[model samples]
Every structure is written in structure tokens, then in C-alpha cells.
Target: MKRIVAAAAAALVLAAVAACFVYWDTVRSWLPQEVAAVLGAETEDGGGERDRSAVAVRLAPVELATALDRFETSAEVTAAEAVEITSEVAGRVETVLVEDGQRLEKGAPVIRFDDASEQAAVNAARAALAEAEAALGRSQFLFEKGVATEARLETDRAARSTARAELEAAQARLEDRRVRAPFAGEVGFVAVDEGAYLSPGQEIVRLKTTDDLRLRFDLPLEVAEQAAGIGALRLVSGPEGCRQARLLTVSPLGDPTSRTRRFEAALPDGCDLTPGAFITVAAVTGRCPEAVFVPHKAVERRGFESFVFRAEETDAGLKARRTLVKTGVLTGRRIEIREGLDEGDRVVAEGLQKIEDGAAIRPAGEEARR
Candidate 1:
């Protein structure tokens, strides 16, 4: 009786297994594709000859897109005027006229050296010049009156000329004692203090014009030709908002190492940017009014030729047609198909290596829809 019960249980288990096998297709249809595939599902379309051998692939469409002909590159901000401040004459600093980050006008005093000595020297030279001038006048009068020799008049004239030269020299030296700004700008720093000795050519500060800035950058060789037509640009760095820049100039010589051309654009008025600040520049080179774009993965290059597996609908199912295509600008994820492609054409976006020319294919999403 126990053996009879065991045999009946075994028969019931076998019947259940057979029922599951018979309904496996119906069960797989309810499950997800990944789960169904794991359970030995057929990789095919609905009851078609091509579907029996169809390869699973993801599809992307080749459609007309507005291709904005533009490029982005690194750039730097430049000042209208920038100079390193240094004293022309060595002296003891009487006072530092400017501090770090000070705004000043042209000819504004940056540092005042010990000008007392310079002033005294200038005064003495002026007195000597006045005396020499008086003596020269007297000597000229005497010579005219036959009371002085011609050689005496000549000597007086020479003395007067030498005195004038000495006075001018003293005045120049006095001017050197007070270091002034060459242009209206903001100063970086004043390194010296009152009563501190400063050597000639020692950097006192750096003066840079903060407004009317410019952008300088190198443009690629391919787009450098359009530098002329690209008159305006947009800067992508600095501040919260973006502003436009006008084309200033392009260097005649190209960079040998980068194989690019240098470009400069003038920033607008009231710009907050300063010299040496880095920026990103965007410029429009050209535009393609009508262009067929495809996913970059769909296109592959073998040696000299480039090709894409485009999906072609047939009575049996979809087939991958290995179509040769001419490629254009490849920016980001989309690639421009210059030739051999049109709008509404579907191309394989994923699993490109698994499929070959004329290979049967089924859209991976088709299973989910069914």
C-alpha cells in the first residue's frame, strides 16, 4: 500500500512538469524579455522566416536635424592695459601712495620716495642756472660795448648752456622720485612702506585696467577659416550671466605645436572680468540647413570606409543593410551622415558587432509591445 501511494505521487509530479512545458511559451509572454531570454526563449519575430534567425538589437532613427555649426574652446580674459610697476630710481620710500587693489587714474602717484634731496638738488641747479643766465647777459652787453672779449662772451654762453642742462637733469631726477601710474587702472599691491629702501627696477605693484576686457584663445585649424565671418561670440565663464564679445583680431601666424590660430575678442563695456581669468568661448562657424543625424554607435569605420547597419523592413522581417555613409561633423552623441542616408531610416544603435550585412534582426522593444 505504501509503494502504491509513492507511485501515485510520482505520476502526479510528472503530469505537472509536462503541463508546464506545454505552456512555457504562454508563461514567457507574460514575463520580461530578459527573464524570458534566460529561460531559453526564441530570439525571433512573430512566426516569420527571417525571425527564426533574427538578431536582437536596439534601434535609433536617422532623421533630419538642425545641425548648429559651432565649436567650443578654452580661452583667457585680458585687460585693456596691464603693466608691472617698478621704480626707475633707487631711494628711501617716503610713503606708499597706493595699497593693494587700489583704483587710480593715469599719472596717479603710486609711491613717494625721499624727494627732499631731489627737490633740493633741483633748487640748487635752478639757482646756478639763473646766475649763469645773468652773467651771460652781462657778458653779451659788455662784448657789444667793446668792454668784454668775444671769447669771454662765448665762455659765459657755454656756462649758461651747461647750467640749463644740469637743471633739466635735476628736474628729471625729481620726477623719477615720485613713481606714477602709466594708465588708469587697479593696482595689485604696494610691497614697500614708509622709510623703506627700494632698489631700482624693484616691482612696487601691478597696474591693470579692469574694464574693457578681451578674450584670447586658440581656434582649431578646421574652423579657423570661419574666424572672419564669426564676428561675435558668447563667453561661458565668469559671473552668473553670459555676455557677448566682438571679434578683435586673429594672429597671422599659427601655433606650430597646436596647429591652431590665435583669436582675440573684445569684451563689452562694464565687464567685471580681469586679466588672466580663464573662460570658455563658443563661436558659430557654419550651419547645415538639412542634415541626417544618427547615433554614433550605429556607424563604424573599417579602414577607409565608414558604414552603418540600417534596418530595412521586409515581408519576412527586418534585415540589417550595411550601408556605406559619408560622415561629417561628429559632435557629442550624434554623427552627421553627409551622404547615403535620409530621414525616417532606422539604424541599429546597440549590439552593432553581433549583426552583419543582410542579417535578420528584431527590435528589442518589439517583445515588450507584444
Candidate 2:
């Protein structure tokens, strides 16, 4: 009975050993190859003949040009000349010569005041002058005939001069009743209509000369320094493409609170832009001749560490090496490569997800492993 139990135990142990050998032998060979396969793909830089087939990478010719750092700023539109019209005389408004929003010529009559009193005064003065002149003629004749004294003739002459002066003064007062435009402009809403009583120095209307419209904006101090020498900057209306302007002035002093420089630009005549319409201003600040740029996607930053991929040819063919790089300004989709790269160095642009360091790869030209 004991020998039968020992035989059963021996058979169980042998069978377990055989099964373990079968599994290990079959899987071990494929394990190394499968694990390294992923590494191989990631390490393959897409430049070599094998790399070209592994991933489709298109190359672009590098060009030399200036790159701008675009900044969006808030701006305001202002009229070049605006004025509030006021009446200078005290009287009843006889007639409002111009309507609201009417374009007026320089020196055009804008408002008329009642001048009947002044006209009546002028008539009275004229009659008085005629009576005085007759008396003066009689006095002169008497003085010449040796009947009147010289003093009496002088008194009659003075009275005639006073009457003439009074008539001239009344006519001048009548002219003051008509208010004319100080300059050519478009009139705003008239505050007082015809027949409204106007006191001295009452506001009448607002007038604006809109021949040259302006767009004023403030820029940062650093940006202003670079653009200070630019005499004229070109302005394109956003999306509308309907208007443009030239630089007018740059303020020497900056705002205390905002710490920004102020600038003004003028639009040409017949421009469709209206005052108070917001627009963008582009100021170019020259170029950097020694700048080297790369795709923004190729750079990866973790903590304080920044890295890029560099492709090189090896005995096993092309491979990607992770390289640490220092970078500069990022203009659009490209970034300036300050270090860790040189001209003509091939880089990986896409398909970096599966790549691993020191992995064996079946690139475009290399044969697939069995």
C-alpha cells in the first residue's frame, strides 16, 4: 500500500515539471522580441528610408523672414474737432436757420434773434439826424452873416455828429442778432427750437468737423519703446477690411495708473470708419537675423526640464535621441530654438506616442523581424 502511494506522488511531480517546461520554452523566445518591438518603433526617427515608410513625414523648406509678436490692445475712436455752440445775445429766437445733423458752411447763419427793437431805434436816430442837420445849416448861415456867435455854430455841429453816431450804433446792434457758424461742420441736435427764449451764453447746439477721423490707443511701455521711431503705422479694420489709417502722434508721457503710452492715428478722407469705432493697430518692430525656429509641438517641458528629439544614423540604422534644449520666443506655430539643435538636423514631427528610448525598430527600409 505504501509503494502504491509513493508511485502516485512521483507521477504527479513529473507531469507538473513537463507542463512548466512546455510553457516557458514556447513563450520566452517571443517575449524578448515583443517587448523590444515597441521600443524599436519609438526610437526610429522618421528620416531614413525605413523611417519614411514607417511614418509619412513631409518636409518644408526653411525661409528667412521677420516674425512679429502680435499683441491685442484696447482702443478708442475720437473725432478730430468737436465744438458746443452757444448763443451770445439775449432775445427771443426768431428763426433756427439750420436743422439737427445738417452740414453747415463756415460763417453760415445758424440762429436768428428778434431785431425789431434795434431796427426802430435806427429809424428814430435817422430822423433825429435830419432835424439836427437843418438846425446846423441855419446856424452856419447866421454865423457867416455876422448875426450868430461862433460858439452857437459849434454846438449845432456837435448835435448833428451825435445823431449820426447813434444811428450807426443801432445798426451794429442789429447785426449782432444773427448767429453764424464759427467753422464748417455737421450740427448736432439744436437745444432750443425757434421762438424759444435764449438768455446770454445759452447752449444752442454741438458741431463736429469730421474730415479726419481718429483712433487712439495705448500700448505697453516696452512695446512703445520699440515702436517709438515708427512715424506711421498702418491700421486695418478687423474683418471688415474697409478702412486704414496712418500714425498721427505718440505721446511722450505715459499714463500713471496704467503705465502705458498713448498713440493717435488718422484716417484718410472718404473712409467708411466712423468716430468711436474700435479697431486694431499693427506696429512692426524690425527682425531678428539670427533666429532658429522649430515646430512648437516638438518641444516638451516637464517641471523645469525641456527636451527635443534628434535623429541620427547608426549601425542599426536611424534612431531618435532625446535632447535637452533651451528655447526662445514662440511665434505662431513655431518656436525659436535657442540651443540643442543645428541646421540640417532631422526631427520627429509626429507619431511620437509609441516611441521609447533605445528601442529596436523596423523602419521604412529595414526588414521585419520573425
For model 1, the local distance difference test gives 0.84
> Model 2 misses residue 143 by how many Å?
5.2
Per-candidate TM-scores read: 0.72, 0.56
Model 2 stretches astray by more than 4 angstroms: 1-65, 69-79, 126-150, 212-215, 238-246, 269-279, 291-370
Q: Model 2 residue 92 lDDT?
A: 96
lDDT of 2 by residue, 1-370 (tens): 9999999999999999999979765765465443344345445543345443333222222323455544455566667887778877899999988887798989999888998998898899889999999999999999999999999999999999999998888888887888888888888668888899998889988877767677789898877887767755556454355345677799999888998999887766776655657877675666667666777777788899877666666786656677788876678788877678876765555435445444333322122342
The residue-level lDDT of candidate 1 at 56 comes to 75
Cα lDDT, all candidates? 0.84, 0.71
Candidate 2 global lDDT = 0.71
Candidate 2: RMSD to truth: 10.8
The 10-residue segment of model 1 with minimum total lDDT is: 37-46
List, residue by residue over 77-106, the lDDT tens digit for candidate 1: 878777888878788988788888889999
